[model samples]
Target: MSALAMNETLTIARLGQRGDGVAETVQGQVFVPFALPGESVRAVRDGDRAQVVEILTPSASRIAAICPLFTRCGGCAAQHMGEGLYAEWKRQQVVTALSRAGLETEVLPVVDAHGVGRRRVTFHARREDDGMRVGFMVAGTHDLIEVQACPVLAPGLERAPIVAQHLANRLRASNKPLDIQLTASEAGLDVDIRGHGPAGDALRRQLTEAAERLDLARLAMHGEIIVERRAPFQLMGKAAVTPAPGGFLQATSEGEAMLSRLVLDAIPKAKRVADLFAGCGPFSVRLAEKAQVSAFESDKAAIQALSRAANHTQGLKPVAAEARDLFRRPLLEHELNVFDAVVLDPPRAGAEAQVKRLAASKVPLVAYVSCDVGSFARDAALLVAGGYALERVTPVDQFRYSAHIELVGVFRKTAGRK
Candidate 1:
């Protein structure tokens, strides 16, 4: 065996972004896969590098992953850490980010909103001579690891790949690959077929036939390929969800609904609500039924979705949609007065500039939902410096069995009444 092939015992000092055990051997820095922090491992730096010869000491937070594909699939990184500890790591991550920014706010314990109505999911597919193959990318590479089921998908979406593969072949359109996205709602699945629309209903019929054979929930097609059944979805705001394929949405249905409710709980009943960075208006539309919901997003497509959802309802507060480069051009101080309560849901980058504006603004209340702890914490600090008391930071387990943590927090001026 080559010297590199020999297994050597080493201790992992820290965790890497991809959840690998990051440690340095006397020889050099070595990254061992599947080794947990605090564990001592004997590993061979194989091309696929990882081996846990022995765990000298285990982390209190270390826990086994439930999914068989947990280690091999790149979709999840922190699954090996148990839920309780996972929540804490995420919480601490958030706290640390805020502290670095000089913001102080009380972060509440994480909330678990598992097994509920998550709205949108995107699936990948590959064209092959035999047929189309679909599944998530293999853990770290572009290579596809085809599978019949994905535990992370909503129960209905487990067959998404199977359905998409069949349609691509039946349509005789293997040249253009397909990305199938499913969005769920009370009405059912809204299927968005992205990439290559077939010319007419004749093609739609062939696509429909393919969908029927696969036992799909609903079916739609993009340019050339057909979409399978799932849910009837409109992007919610002015967004098409298609143009921005990776737009942020609640990864799970339960978490999405819960986040909306939390915002409602935090804000006092008001005539207006400002949803900053609102993608597709899931919160804005729901809130619009009661209070006028103003949804702001950088993407025009998202604004359109919000507008349509707003128009569909009655006895509902009006929905106003606006497109702005928020990161570049955030709402000014004078504009903040239009809203009594602000519901800001930024991406993992979080709302740093918005938080600064919020802190200095006289707005009485704020509801913040974040996916990344670091950004959330930084913004939380800003909110704190602005005289807002961190009412609570509740972690929402939208991505179960994964290290990612979502937080919904309500903040208000310390001097202002709750």
Candidate 2:
């Protein structure tokens, strides 16, 4: 066997699932980051992974990255590709996953839901000898890369890094690594700091003063509220939801609205709808506008927020919420039969247990929202085998210039099949 060379020029044949370029080599397939297909690049090979040393010939799809920290920060992966190629690669992710599951269906063009970019941004902070360092971690390393500006953030969150640094400086006395989650809401920035222990009276006072100076709407530490200048509320259709501290939210407002529209349109006439894995009633509250919604989630805070929003809103049908772990005790066939349609937005793992029961139910329509295409394909195949036909699949690009893709699949029960 020929010895594998440490440095070699190779042609990228394709893009991998994580947005890395795959180059076939004598040793094996080398995964090169920031190299697009049809491009020739020189890389230092280490087994299957390679670090691109230089681009010998760039692909036609290659484009300059908007962010200066594109290669340094782990937040984005596909920013170097042209807009058309970027969208096609993301769409292909869904198509490849469904193909692997032996399912073929019509997939609509990818939706550009990254309107003004992400509304929520998380920055890592640590006390430095000079002062404090706040930024995203380096790609594939724990080292922090201090950022002065970020291009992918919404206009409302343009000062997120600065705001995080300000908080880090105020809490520098703790000398602990912290994760500052800044979410842009209608009121103002909702700040949540994690990894810090319970604050003392002095620290609490400092935080209060910082919040006032920063003009923050609310501040929380370790999921506990410290101060509230105003309620950090998000409008979902006609309902107002104050999500829990550090709770899950759609990356962008446009993405949430797009996903909700796709979901609602799938089950248009659903008299009774069951929203599984409902987080803060993003889909449940909207669905309730035309259907009675029964939302089930594991987070107590999320369920409370959903119920409160549902109760306070007017002209909507009944909306009930239960804090239940659907993974452990999914709504069974008989329980699922009560609802005419079901909508589920499961995490990356894709709600296997709940999907199994849903496949056995007599529900006429289903809207499956997923972030992980592989898991979505697995569950989708299950539904297909259970006599449901995939009506349409729409890929949502909430995380632009990155490998991550979100999708909503609409399925309807077909006749003459159990």
Candidate 3:
């Protein structure tokens, strides 16, 4: 083999943003998958990336991965790191992102929100000559890695793999690629199958039978319900919500609770609050427990779900939900000033346009919940420039072992400051 493709010993110096270990090579920095900082490894180098051939010296922080499918399945990245290293790595992701944006604020240690593991997962299914394979894709590849079980899944989803395979088998005749999404809800497993295109009435009947046999709570194809044995309900605070099929949700139940707690605690004195980019009222329903909340979201289905949940729940402060694309038409300064505080849990893009409005508004408190730290940092800088003191940021690790980090930040308006 040429030097470029031969096995070479390298010392991992640090973990990169994607949880890959970085080593300073003679050529440049080489990234090795499944390697850890302070570990020396023999790997086959191909340009800037390498596959570890052997671990010559292991890092002290390295631990046995809980999942047997750890390195094979692309579901997790930091399974090898010990608890201390894992927590620090996740927390530093927030701190570094904020620092790059020139916003200096206290970032607390990561909160462990991996309670009962992930409640939702998507398994890709493809048919082979022998049979159909269902599991996660290999890291950086389209190839599927068959999984019998996943340690990172909640107990309610222990049968997700089996259920996915069963569904795939039912649709095997389509000969098209399939993506099956299963979510653990109070009613049972809510399943949504995609990638096989529109389903005919015949296929829907077949799927309905399959769902019945498997005892599924509900089944949908491409977000269209095939069978509804029961409503897939999720509890947000005291409200029972039936989120739109395949809608966005926090990875874990615990993650949502932690993020909600942080948001609620930040604006305790506020009477009226605005929830921008609110999805199915996770925070809105909870915030309504103590304050009147106005929620704005782009998805009409989500808005309807939130409204229905709010209306059905008792003893909650008035919750008014409106379907408005905040990106195109953010609430203006005058409209925003009506609320004492704003709690926004935007998508990964963050709420740049809406934050700009909040920055100029008289809203005294802003609780920002974010999934992407880079975008969050950029918006945080904008808020600080507008005279909002970023009190603190807390990183919550719901996607454990993965590089993704969620955070909640509290920003208070400074009196007489621009």
How many steric overlaps are in each model, in order? Answer: 44, 0, 0
lDDT of prediction 1: 0.69
Q: For candidate 1, lDDT tens digit of each residue in 182-213? A: 65543444455666555476777776776667
**Model 2 CA deviation exceeding 4 Å by range:** 1-5
Over 1-418, each residue of candidate 2 has an lDDT whose tens digit, in order, gives 1266488898999999889999997778989999999999988887888889999999999998888888999999988999888888899999999999999999888999998889999999988796889999999999999998888888889878889999999888888999999999988999999988998899899999999999999999988999999999998999989999888899999999999999988988889999999999999999999999999999999999999999999988999899999999999999999989999999999999998888888999999999999999999999998889998899999998888999999999999764
Expressed as tens digits, the lDDT of each residue in 318-357 for candidate 3 is 9999999999999999999898999998888988998898
Which prediction has more favorable lDDT, 1 or 3? 3
Sort by TM-score, top down from the best? 3, 2, 1
Q: Which candidate is the best by TM-score?
A: 3
Error of 1 at 267 (Å): 1.5
- Determine the backbone clash count of candidate 1: 44
User: Distance (Å) between predicted and true CA of 378, model 1?
Assistant: 4.0
State each model's CA lDDT, in order: 0.69, 0.92, 0.92
Off by over 4 Å in 1: 1-6, 13-18, 22-31, 45-64, 116-120, 171-173, 185-188, 195-205, 212-248, 352-360, 381-391, 414-418
Q: How does candidate 2 fare on TM-score?
A: 0.97
Question: Candidates' TM-scores?
Answer: 0.79, 0.97, 0.97
Worst 10 residues of 1 by lDDT: 237-246
